[model samples]
Target chain A: MNWLTWRQHRAQFLFGAATLAVITLFLVPSGLGIWHTFRSTGLAGCLAVTGRDCGDLASTFSDRYTGLQFTIPLFMILPALLGVFWGAPLVAREIEQGTHRLAWTQGLTRLRWMSTKVVTLVLATLAGAAVFAFLLSWWSRPFVAASDNRFSFGVFDLRGIVPVAYALFALAAGVAAGALIRRTVAAMGATLGAYVAVRTGIELWARPHYEAARTISYSFFGSGPHPGSGDWVLSTRTVDRAGHLLGNGQSLDFNVLHARCPDLPGPSSGFVSKAPIQACIQRLGIHLQATYQPGNRYWLFQGIESAIFVGLALGLLAFAVWWVRRKVA
Target chain B: MTTPAALTATALGKRYRGHWGLRDCSLEIPAGRISALVGPNGAGKTTLLHLATGLLAPTAGTIETLGRTPGEDPDLLPRIGFMAQDVPLYRSFRVREMLEFGRRTNPGRWDAELAQGRMDRASIDLDQRAGTLSGGQRAQVALALALAKRPELLLLDEPLAALDPLARREFLKALMEGAVDGEVTVVLSSHLLTDLERVCDHLVVLSGGRTQVAGDIEGLLEAHRVLTGPRRDVDRIEGVAAVVQQATTDRQSTLLVRTDGPIIDPAWSVHRVDLEELVLGYLGQPNATALPAPRLARTGAEVSR
Candidate 1:
């Protein structure tokens, strides 16, 4: 059974191997060069030193290596590709060719067939996803450090174990869709759509709420309790004395000065300079409120997101098995 | 259940969407007999075969193969072989790979020697990709796979549809020759009444989601005879009034009757009915309630013979 599965999926395995080779070929030299430049140009030295500005070194390093950074973003669709090519075709091809009936009646029980085929493909997916994430994380170490921000959306998804989860979830969704639809191309399209919808939905709507975001409110003019660059600042608002949440922080002057400083002489003319408005806001004791997920919770968020996707993947897989056993005609 | 019949169904039915595909289907096929399941396009022959293979579950009642529930026991799968319509093969796989698939999946039960012998006789090369094979070649390969598994029961659905007349004759010969060597019970479904008549001794005719007629060919043929008698209703016969068809002219009546004993009416002249006429008669009138059922109720002992 295992041999049969391997023979059936040999092309997909070869494709995965070739992709891993290509990625390795491209990223290894580029990553080593980035690390070398970081050390050779004294950027690493400047960062380590306490009082050094590191501005020139940092800009020089960024200028030299920024072009290669765009290469990493191309792999953003790797999980989607796995879903379309490897996962969706797994069962749909069998059904389309009518080999599913052949296999099922070959004294190969449905349980063994599903376990051998689905498990091997999903395991391959896990390995491929893990390798890509590891390579990208290693390659992006310099960039992540220089910006002091790895918690951003695109960077966060590709740099940690969540990519592995995403790939597994995509593969499982593809297999499930293939089992249900029984047509290869349509199942691939559905898998792609579902993978994007679910991943982005969780990233956009549910990720921030994984943990209650801590908020810091400080006086408008005075910078206090500043959010770290690594922190994911979900929202920032400037409130007036009446406590209405302001839209954009740039319009802080319009929101505060007119509301609390009605007694000021500038009621007839808008102040072009910043001195009077700052003084008025300082006197009014207005504050800026910012909500953020702390930087230290990066691994914690990874764990939570990975758990959700893995759970979903398992559920989809179970549904697929049920469908194959009971519903397939 | 004295000695379990090779295949048994009790009020078996299958439904697709909202409509019944096979309804009130009940029959028993004895072991070691080559039975032909004949039906027209919408007669649920494929549905019944798939249900017996456990590929399609029943919507009502039950089906058992080899004295066990189909697909329920792990051990039962290896004992049964099925060739689906068009004899589906992994087109991407070489013929050798398909053989290997059968061998691996069946474990110790695969008869590699028999499979190779059949393949060689069919003139199919082991290295040829299944996609490149002709329809006749595909059927040969599929049959080899099923026979190679050394199953006690073999079910084939429309295996001859892919063959030319000559090839179908050869294929049926090969099937019987192969099945006879292993004492295998084979139930094959097809629309070719002529071909089945030549090869099969047992018969099952399906029409309107029901088993219109079923019995051993010799018994069915013996029970039914064309009777030419003075003009009268078929029910006026002195035995089981199982008239398949009745045609009356001004002075005489000719009717096909299936009965428990030979018609003894001296006013009647009786002639034998062939397999083709018998099959067509049942299939043509799907709504006929007076079934030619003398052979329909065969005892287990009678079937085992």
Candidate 2:
């Protein structure tokens, strides 16, 4: 079984490894370049200390690595690519070409054949995703340290154990779709669509509710409670002294604001407006209330998301097994 | 000798989306016999072969091959070899590599010597890719792989459908040579009766998703007769047997019938029916009764006029 599994998937495994190597070769030099620029600009020491913001030098470093930043999102797409090319085609191609009859009729049972392929390819997907995440993490370290938005969707998802989990889910989805659809191209399309749907669902609806978000309200005209620089700020709203949550900007009436402050700066006004809106909000005892997931909860969210995806992946695999046994004929 | 059945299917049936592909099919193939399963294009021949090989699960009843439920236990896998329709092979691998695939996958039970010997005897190149091989070579490679498993029962579905006549003959010759001297029981399905008569001793014919006839080839041919006579009502003919099928032209009526009583009508001529004629006779008629055997009985040489 081991020998057969290897022979069957050796091409996909090699292609994944080669792609990882190419990505590593691309990241290492660019990473070093960022490190060198940070050190040469003397912002590395300044960033290491307290009460100093190296925003300018950080911006310069970011500007130098703009091309690298574009590639960071590409890391997020690798798992889906694995799903489409490696996972979808695994069983779909076999059934499509009718070689599954050959494979299933051997000394091994169809269940064993399917389980071995699924397990082996899943391990390979994890290893590939891990190597990719590690390389991308190394490349993005400087930018991550300089930015406060590391907990944002794009950055957090590609850095830790979650990418591996996502890879597992993607592969399982592909396999399930392939087993059901029995066509490689259609399965690949379904895998992509499902991956995107699940990712979007988690980012928009599920991730925020993983833990109750912490809200900090502060005095008017002041920065809201610091949930740490790396924390994910979900939303900031104005709250009155009566503790009523102000509707967001969409519901606020500009006409009422203009009527309240006839002397307010208009579009054609050349003068700079300092605090007209601030004064009005302060007069109403409006406070800045920021709701966010703290940086300390990053691992908690990661664990929750990984568990969700892994659970889904296992369910998809079970479905595939059932489909093969009961529905494939 | 009363050998045990290699395969026994009881009340076997398979239903597709809207209709049944095979229904109420029951058969028993004797051990150490070369059997042929014949049917038309839409008949249930492939469905029955698939059910026996465990490639498909019967929807209604049970089918057991080699004394075990087909595909129910992994241990039973090595005991039954199946070469599916089209002889599907891994085209990407070299011929030798394909053999190696069988070796690796079957593990401790694979017969490497038999595989290599068969390929060598066929003059198939070891280095040639399976996809690049001619149709006959591909079939040979597939057959060798199935035979190398040394299964007690081998189920082949339309194995010779795509081959040229010469290749077909050679392939059947190779199959018979390998099967005749052993305890191997082979069930081969094809629409062509001539391809089967030379190699197969047992027979089963499927039509309209039902088994029309089944028996030992000799017994089936011996039990059936084609009676030709002056134009007369077949229903009124004396000493007439079970009317399997009948055809009539302007002054002649020919009836293929299964009988236990002798034909005594002086106006009619009695002739032995061949395997092909018997199979075509049953296949052309729907709702045929349970045949005494799955093999079409071979017609005797002497005909009493």
Candidate 3:
């Protein structure tokens, strides 16, 4: 079986490697440019707001670096096309060409012939996915680190471990579609459609929940000084000027403040004076904390998603195996 | 008589979408005998061949090759080489590659020298792509692939249908020479009666999904006769047991009669039918005993007997 598969796909494997090399050459310069841009701008303190330093420039770079996002997805698309154009035609072409009859009437069973093909293609798909994932991960690190926008989340979210899952899923889905459709063109189209839908669905609706759970916010304002204070008379409000909540802005009214600051002893005792407005105003600076952090959760989510997709891929692979085994031609 | 049967179909039947392709079509070919399956366009000859070779599953029957069911055992496949009608081959593969593929996949012991000899006799170039060959040349290649397996039984569907007379004769001569040792039993189907008569010893005639007549070629011809006379005198013919075919116009009548006795009628003339006439007579008859099966010897029976 291994020998047969190797004979069948040796051409495609060589072609795939050449294509990957060309893509890598193009990506290297682009990756270096991204790294230089990141170095020229400050690492942490770069202002990413108002489309000047942080918001618009960062968004434009993120969009330009969109090619990095496409690397894994594009690599994944190759296997599906292989399955459809090359792999799907594996059995059907034999039957269509009437070579299968000759082969089957020999000592080899139809099941064995199909099994060899699927196993070989699956291995190829994995190897391709692994190489692409490694290159994309290495290339897109600087850009991924620089961008803080939610849109950047979609592009680089599946970077480290998730692309593996995406690739496997795409491969399995392509093979299954090929088996079911039995035509090269139809199988390719179906595989692409299914991959796009599943990947898009996961990124848009399901991924944000992991990041939303871990955010924190804070705000502050200045207030007048108290007469009985020992050294300084000046005072300040901890909250913003309009009294709006900060750090991912959720409102912090009196009830919320009291609930959070229940152990503050007497508010007036904590302050120099017992003036309620002044004491309350002094403690008005806002702080909000969430349990889940986006970056940390991103890896966890990637790992979990990869596992789920891997399982789905296995299921699809099993179906493809079963389908090939039962194939009549 | 002690040797194993080369091919056997026991109550083999196949149906496609409620239409009968083959039904209760049972046959056995003893080793060394050249058997021919003669049928019309839709007589299910291809279906029967496919079933016998395990290319298709029988709807309700069994096919055995060398005492083992071909469908149940993959090992049996290599022992019986088959050439399907129109002989589809990979256009990209040269003759050498095609033969190499056959050698790689076939489990039986193949004689490379013997295959080369057969190819040489058929005048097929090893370097030419199968698609580039003429129709007759392609047929020769197909035959070469089957012969390479050195199979115990070879099933060919319309082996010479596309060949010119000269090529057909060459193919038959080569096939006869190849099977001279009586190790190979052949069951081939052909619409051309003369080709079957030249190479085949036994005959199985199928019409409308059933075996209409089957026997040694000589025996089939000996039992059937063609009678031509005036339309008014057709019923008056005497000493005839059965009429297999009858065509009546206003002026004259022609009848195909089957009988074991001598024809002595002065008013009617009886001519001994050839295998062609006999097969045509049976095929022409609407009610010519579906599966008019003849007794055949088991494997290793003498062809002359």
Top-scoring candidate (lDDT): 1
RMSD of 3: 9.9
Please write out the lDDT profile of model 3 over residues B139-254, one tens digit for every residue.
87877788878888888988888889988887787778777754888998987788778778888887776666766677767767887777764553456656777888997877
RMSD of each: 3.8, 3.8, 9.9
- Candidate 1 chain B: minimum summed lDDT over ten consecutive residues — where? B296-305
Candidate 2 error regions (>4 Å)? A243-258, A261-281, B236-239, B293-305
lDDT of each: 0.83, 0.81, 0.67
Each model's interface RMSD (Å)? 1.0, 1.4, 2.4
Write the residue-wise lDDT of candidate 2 on A77-141 in tens digits.
Answer: 88889889888987899999999888888887888888888889988888888888787777777
What digit string (tens of lDDT, one per residue) describes model 1 on residues B1-305? 24347899889999999888899888888888899999998889999988998888999989999988876777788999999997889888899998998999999899999999999999999999999998888989999999999999999999998799888977887798789887899999998889888889889888888887777799888877888878975556675346667778999987776666757878898889999987887666564432224434443112210
How close is every model to the real structure, measured as TM-score?
A: 0.92, 0.93, 0.76
Candidate 3 lDDT over A140-229, as tens digits, reads 666655554212444444367776677778777877776677665667777778877877787666654543443333323322221111
lDDT at position B187, candidate 2: 92
TM-score of chain A of 2: 0.89
Candidate order, lDDT descending: 1, 2, 3
Score residue A269 of candidate 3 by CA lDDT: 57
* DockQ-sorted candidate list, best first: 1, 2, 3
Clash count (model 2, backbone only): 12
